[model samples]
Target: MAPRDGTPDATGAHQRTPGARELNAAARVFALLADPTRLHLVWLLSRAESDVSALAETVGAARPAVSQHLAKLRLGGLVESRKEGRRVVYSLPDGHMKRLVVEAISHADHQVTGEPWHD
Candidate 1:
């Protein structure tokens, strides 16, 4: 497919800092986190894992709504869960997911706080 800016063959993937597959995966990740609820979920997961009920309480969202969001995250491979009795504890899927979430949150903080990192 052509690039979003209409540069199908323009110096594009041929010289990008990242490969097409990597860029595509990144896009998928961002798309998943595009929703407000999803972003909040990622923000919470950035800290530690929690069950759906705890997530709902912390995010001020309903239990079903929180579960739905967790489902999406799980499908996207950005989250993983385990059963602790009846509660399903969710956490960042892996180091890659953690890096992506942290980068997004850092970018957001920079945008809002106007604080740029030299490195």
Candidate 2:
């Protein structure tokens, strides 16, 4: 099948398209990020590893709400946590997630500020 972008697969053989399951997984991740609070949490985590309290204070959200968002993010594989003494520090698992959040915020900023899109 033709790839979604209409480009040949990396193999340079048949065009590889994303299957329904792959699309659904991506959609589910986007759905999880649809919340402003969650997106804020992700943006913060993208910067550095932080605990719940720090995340809450930084985002101006309640601790519980931030914890809940962190929980969801952790479950979705967007973030990972490790026990640091008595505190559980959360951080983005990889650079891919960080780039995704950064690009999303940049896009939003452009739209909000009426800036022209740039490559």
Candidate 3:
């Protein structure tokens, strides 16, 4: 069983503690997520794959700005894009990433609503 504490559980035989490099990489991901525009784009991608125009319209940002954020996210491996004929659709490549984004937003909602935290 997993540990009740926040530390990684040791119950699994295949599990290994994260190294400094791994922790640094996670920190980088958090740094990228610190930006509101990028976070919004990620949140949108977590919902559905969207093209540049649609993403810009939905996020209420200019096309160039949204395209820039998407470019950065793509480079960081947080998202992936595929050519859908004339348009390129963007999506979160990993299910874990979707869950992470949703959880972060939910945490923020809890803070804003003054709700008690739960595991």
What does candidate 1's lDDT look like per residue over 24-110, in tens digits?
988998899999888888879878999999899999999999999999889988899999998899998666667767877888889
- Candidate closer to the true structure by TM-score (higher is better), 1 or 3: 3
TM-score of each: 0.76, 0.85, 0.86
Worst 10 residues of 3 by lDDT: 5-14
lDDT of 3 by residue, 28-103 (tens): 8888889999999999989998999999998899999998999989998899999989999999998778888999
Clashes in model 2: which pairs? none
Report the number of the highest-lDDT candidate: 2
Q: For model 3, how many clashes?
A: 0
Candidate 1 backbone collisions, by pair: none
Give the winner by TM-score: 1 or 2. 2
Give the better candidate number (2 or 3) by TM-score. 3
Model 2 per-residue lDDT tens digits across residues 1-119: 54656465775433546789878987888988999999999999888889999999998989998999999989998899999899999999988788889999999999999999998
Stretches of candidate 1 off by over 4 Å are: 1-18
Candidate 2 stretches with Cα past 4 Å from truth are 1-15
